[model samples]
Target: MDCCTPSAGRPSTPVAAPPPGSGDHRIEQVSVPAQTFAMGDAHGDGAPGDGEQPVHDVRVPAFTIDATSVTVADFRSFVTATGYRTDAEQYGWSAVFHLALTDPDQVIGQMQGTPWWLGVEGADWAHPGGPSDVAADDHPAVHVSWNDAQAYCAWAGRRLPSEAEWECAARAGLPSRRYPWGDELPAAGHALNIWQGSFPAVNTAADGFVTTAPVRTFQPNGYGLWQPVGNVWEWVADWFSPAYYAAAPVEDPQGPPDGTARVIRGGSYLCHDSYCNRYRNAARSSNTPDSSTGNTGFRTASRKS
Candidate 1:
């Protein structure tokens, strides 16, 4: 099955949010104004199959979104109150980066295309590297599937940001820059967390992180949103389609009506210039909604009711 595919036997009912102010943690939501901005790959030099083509204009209405990704502490609160189990927990395994694995012998299997990803039993959000590896409270929650994120949103009275809204907020009012900061890449360890040296076998950790970092480790974008381009591949509300930009609506496009996989934006700590430079603002990818990895996480958005 595709990486983003939902499990066949999972429950379909939506979980309701808890009573207001019940949870101890709160996500700081930033208000993004209604505006028309250019979206998609403007540089045209991103990695192939990245679907960064046909730059277009998108007008997104005013919305509020989390200023930072949902940290482990935040998700912990949701799970504590709702008693929900992530897809990773239900499946008894989740994809983990080879570097994060403390014991290679524990790996049950490996992803076909990406051998660097090892399927480790018990590797869920709480156990990023399996039972031996516990997640840090301040780190952004990893190994969360899109389905899991939706569940969290439901419990928090929030929703996932649409691809258009995500890109709009990521740009931070900058029209043509390749990243949230600017066109020039920030020196390693200076800005976002991304692959420093070679990918896969060699990660120099120039950004001071081999795995997930604290959610607010880097500087905020112009809009005060943190790490919009790097750290982890964030799950968006839209479904994935390489050709969606070709005929996408100009105003508030949510993405295709349906798709095999859901959209994931921003690159991850594994991103490198040599390969998968999807750290660019317009770059995007997709995976099965049920897929969860150490390099993926998500923020929340709220629309005025």
Candidate 2:
């Protein structure tokens, strides 16, 4: 259960920005006001088709996200004020996660149904695992695409939270809460940074991390947000439909106007609970908005706070 990677094998287009406000890469956001919750998987514990389930409703009107997940020094200050080139650095390669491969000879191929996902070739987002493995200025920037998080939300004027404003700021309005701190599993030890041991074969970092962990590592969700589920897999702006919750749209439902994958919400650091429990808060998954992987990453949104 490699959480995700490998899709849209090339050209999904849309990654040419600069000049929308162009460069502040702001972070700590929050707001999330306009109510209406119960969006999906009211604990039937989804995953078949993964529309999450019939537990519909939704709403989402206030918006303002990004209380975390976008680091690597806020995407290296938007690639140092937009030199910006990442569709896995223009598809030279990405997807590297054979246990975050430090360099087993920079292997440039894998993913025939997730062979622990190892494409490589200088694995992007500032060399994730190939090429001497850099990247980790406070983690959570991984390989970056959904068209490079819409060119870093069009250079940080911000935009990207719309899986019902990312599950109403990851269920902070807490009701069908499998977690954003609700159903159980946090007496303050592993609030997130998933996968304990035995994933692609023995991680045991317990919570300390085996791949991305500091997007503020843990604790913060009653709207303060941080690490909204596991340590990565964010990228939301819709267009993924495992039957888009049958007829989605209780109010703000902006998804599925077209498709070929887009949505992705929490659940990363490889995730486990016997293979991608999807890290919770009515989990979901998708890719190919120009896929990039090392467990994915994104976070930004604002209709103003």
Candidate 3:
């Protein structure tokens, strides 16, 4: 959950440059369109894991994303337009959600393995359940990293989403399907905002959300974008290496040259199936780019003007 961008809390943004190609702001920036798919399908039947195994073919071309993830008023307008200071508020504390202290007068064990995180201190991302909890300035800003999502995409001029353009905009064409608006899962009510009943304990907000869920709630996929897979896990400038996709490069394969972990892409809101199913769409994971969590978060990319 740590990438490389952690300066402390609140203070980011200052790279600006965008605006000129039709000003699609208000955080609904869609686009996509760059054809070609089938990147991996490790055969869990309809492919479930093995880092989305061998199923190659990428291509890529068109760009633009961020229909969601990066909220909290878009990082408080990039820290009121660039003062930048994240990396989980400078790593004073993070990894929260220890089940609000499983009762018994709140102690229920220190948790860490899966009591549902809980490392808390001052926590970060505007104190998500820490520093006495605050967030909801409009969710989606969970302990950011990858260098505070590249300083909020250089102050929203944009950049960050190149694990083949974040898995070709989270496989919104249904090449394999496990999620990304397919393969059923968002039941009970319909789509978006994960972690339903029986998680660290029980949520049962159904899909209305027991946490997060604001940046456009649910439903959008086929290019309209929004949530890509689940709630968070973006950050893909590329650095991970699970055999470097057997030497990558079917086309737009930029990843691995050196590595300590980076690539994250989709899967958040504590992606279930017991523990990290990677929210599908060619599931892949890696961390430590700087490590900041509570269900990681990031988004922003460009260069297709």
Candidate 4:
């Protein structure tokens, strides 16, 4: 279900590259050497989660990836150049975590169990908090749909990172570790950005900010990539199928041919041990391509020749 598709349930379109000399953006290109890597961890953080076991190998060619998640400034430039409206805007709003919803008017006031997420109107990437809100120019833009991300990437001369490439960069040098840094979770005054205190209602900003920090606010892994394990969950260019990896190709796997959802990597600040602990390096999740939220965004990669 994690592959590309239109909101109407049609097949997704192939992404295009953005025009040259785009403004209001800083692009840092990192080269990825051609190599083979083992994908997945046999041990799923000492749990029995589906699709995480039966560790396997994959081979890839040399390529380049964006050094960080796409920022608000860069997405703004894409909007300026293309004059495009995001899907969330077209849909009228997006899902907002109840705790992040400080404004009463913005809260649609419905619980999906944990009392954390609420469907709010006018909560798209541009208006991250809702209709009355605006995302900081430096923060990574949120509430962007896969289609929106695809359009932005095309207009930015980049493409969404394939799931394989993304996993490799996230793993960095320590392929067997639990996180980009290591197995241990963030301790008092030790690592970079992440959610602190209680979920939504009482955030202490122990790692730094309650909301999304500016990209690279956390320490970079050995690959020089930042915020791979926390902050926001990034959309990858692959369909979501829990059993697909069982039959995935050993060389440059591209996931299932067709599916309902798209793959998302890394965990978000919303991650919690009791609810969802997907913040681990090997963890993954998925949602409809049209689904957008304040905690979701993406990075890009170029195919190796």
Instruction: For residues 1-305, write the lDDT of model 4, one tens digit per residue.
Output: 21111122223544334444534446676677777877786456523433666678888787888778888887887887777777777767677766566456866654344346666877877777777777887787888877788877766667788888888888776667778777887557336455666655787777767778888776778777878777888899898777877788888888888887788888777665554667777878887787777788888888766
Off by over 4 Å in 1: 1-25
Please identify model 3 stretches exceeding 4 Å from their true place: 1-37, 40-42, 45-56, 61-77, 82-124, 130-154, 159-164, 168-232, 235-264, 272-276, 279-281, 284-296
lDDT of 1 by residue, 62-93 (tens): 99989999999999998888788888887788
Sort by TM-score, top down from the best: 1, 4, 2, 3
TM-score of 1: 0.92
TM-scores vs. true structure, each candidate: 0.92, 0.34, 0.32, 0.87
lDDT of 2 by residue, 11-45 (tens): 66775665455687667678878888888788787
lDDT of 1 at 127: 84
Q: Which of 2 and 3 is the better model by lDDT? A: 2
lDDT scores of the candidates, listed in order: 0.82, 0.79, 0.66, 0.72
User: Of the pair 3 and 4, which is ahead by TM-score?
Assistant: 4
Q: For each candidate, C-alpha RMSD in Å?
A: 3.3, 16.5, 16.7, 4.0
